[model samples]
Target: MPVITFANTKGGAGKTTAVLLLATELARMGHRVTVLDADPQLWISRWSEMSGEMRNLSVISHVTMASMETHIRENRSNTDCFIIDLPGTKSPLLTMALGISDHVLIPVQGSAMDARGASEVLEHIELLNRKMGMKIDHSVVLTRVNAMISTRSMLLVKALLAEKNVRVLNTPIAERAAFRDIFDCGGTLEALDCQKVSNVEKAMENVRNFAYEVLRLMPVRVVRSDRDGKFLGRKAA
Candidate 1:
């Protein structure tokens, strides 16, 4: 299983939102997903319950650093994908989550303030990797971006990318109220009313593509799909 964790050192960086959306998308695509909520706030846990798909979804809430490693070791065999929703700040629990993650996705708003905080988190991750001699794949996902505001910040982000050698996914999530409004309803992006905001659909596709790229980088196995024995080729990373 590929264990992906959504994390950042700053609050309100949209880590929870990214995890929820991406996990839902993967689940709808037929992957057996297990979401581990490592945040003390338990926002993702609450949202999962509100989504009313808990019975069908594999979601474990109120997980802390103390218990996370054991849980993963015990349950990893049964899951195809493990998506961990982490707290926004650095803590022992957050560090533990990163230690075990196959990929660490840091969602940042397209703003200088958010970028600065994200850089700090990246530095910490690097330090940990060097100290422990463990390779932890990491990337940045830009969210709540608008052409008007992003035009300038995007340039800043590009400059940082060049200087720091950080990877930024090509897909930028646009600012939309629909993203927030859909949480109360039970569905993934595929089940949303796409007619209202087609852009969201495109954004989601970008996310899925980025995820596939991460999977490719890690060289994880892509399972083939068989619908009533009509075999489809292995899914491309």
Candidate 2:
């Protein structure tokens, strides 16, 4: 299994929503997923409480720097993937999480060029690489994207990422009512009412594409036992 952390030094970068989407989508694909709710806000924790026993999914709330490794070590055997949702603001926890993560995803709003928070995360990663020779894999995910048109701000952000030579995900998370509604409703995108929410099918499709791109970056191998057809993700070699 691989540990993927979603982090941003600034708030409202759409980090939590991306984490939820990836965790839920991976679980839906039959991989056992554990989400560490490292954020103080407990958004994912509250959502998990409301979800009530989803198959192949688990959530550990109130995770801290002290307990994060313990939780991962304890759950490694059962988890196919571990997704950590770090705090919105800069924290010592960010460095600790980034140090251990197989991949760190920094979510930047596609509509705005306010990548200051993302820059902070990038700087930390660079410091780790320079000071400790730790080459941590990471990518910028353009979130809250407008599906209709590519705005000027978004293009500038893309250019800035290119100038820095940072990898960006091919799929951008689009702005959709369903994405917001899932936090309020406390379930997967599939669980959303298609009739009530506009463009739910499109939202689901966008999530699928985003998840697929992530899987390409840090693939998890899953297999089924002969005795029980349940899928089990093999530990990363």
Candidate 3:
């Protein structure tokens, strides 16, 4: 089972936006993606209610630390990918989610606060690896990047992340209005009217790249079948 967990200790790191982008894109690709909305804020849940019906996509709200694994076990039959959206603040739920995740994505901005928040999560992941040998794979994704140009400051930060031996995604999420309007409009990037939203096509391309990298980076493992609960190939292209 490939479960991807998105976590950032600091709010405003664009974590929720990235989660929605990946979830919708995966569903669009014909994968049965189930989003477990663990965040009390329920942004994804609200969006799901508004999205009406998305093919191969479902959202389960009010997820708790106690019922998280239960939901996974029960849905193991139908879910192709489980995406968990954690709260911005660190809590016991964070550790619980990380324990069951196949991969962790940390959204970092070119700011001290975002970096600090990401670092905290990384340390926890490292701790789990060192102590329990969990071997949780993780990467840092730069968010809200300037689309027109990559500033030298951003490059400096990227270099710093590299020096720390952190894996950074080649694709940085651009600061686009389409990403913002999706929350209000209650649909996906494809549903947005390109004529109205600036760079909607560009945003779609960015999301495609982001999702491609995500699928490439996720581990290929045999998991329970959606129908029979037997081992099956989920990484098939």
Question: Per-residue lDDT for 150 in model 3?
Answer: 79
- 1-237 per-residue lDDT for model 3 (tens digits): 589999989988988899999998877776678999999999999998988888778999999999999999999888888999999998999998989998999998888788889988999999999999998989999999998887776777788889999999999898999999999898899899888889899999999999889888877533324543333456443
TM-score preference between candidates 1 and 3, better one:
3
lDDT score of residue 168 within candidate 1: 81
Q: What global local distance difference test value does model 3 have?
A: 0.87
Give the alpha carbon lDDT tens digit for every residue of 14-129 in model 2.
99999999999888877788999999999999999998998879999999999999999999988888999998888899999999999999999853434888999999999999
Q: What is the lDDT for 194 in model 1?
A: 71
Residue pairs with backbone overlap in model 2: 1-235, 1-236
Best by TM-score: 2
Q: Which prediction has more favorable TM-score, 1 or 2? A: 2
Q: Candidates sorted by TM-score, descending order?
A: 2, 3, 1
Lowest-scoring 10 consecutive residues by lDDT in candidate 3? 222-231
Return whichever of 1 and 2 wins on lDDT.
Answer: 2
Number of clashing residue pairs, candidate 3: 1
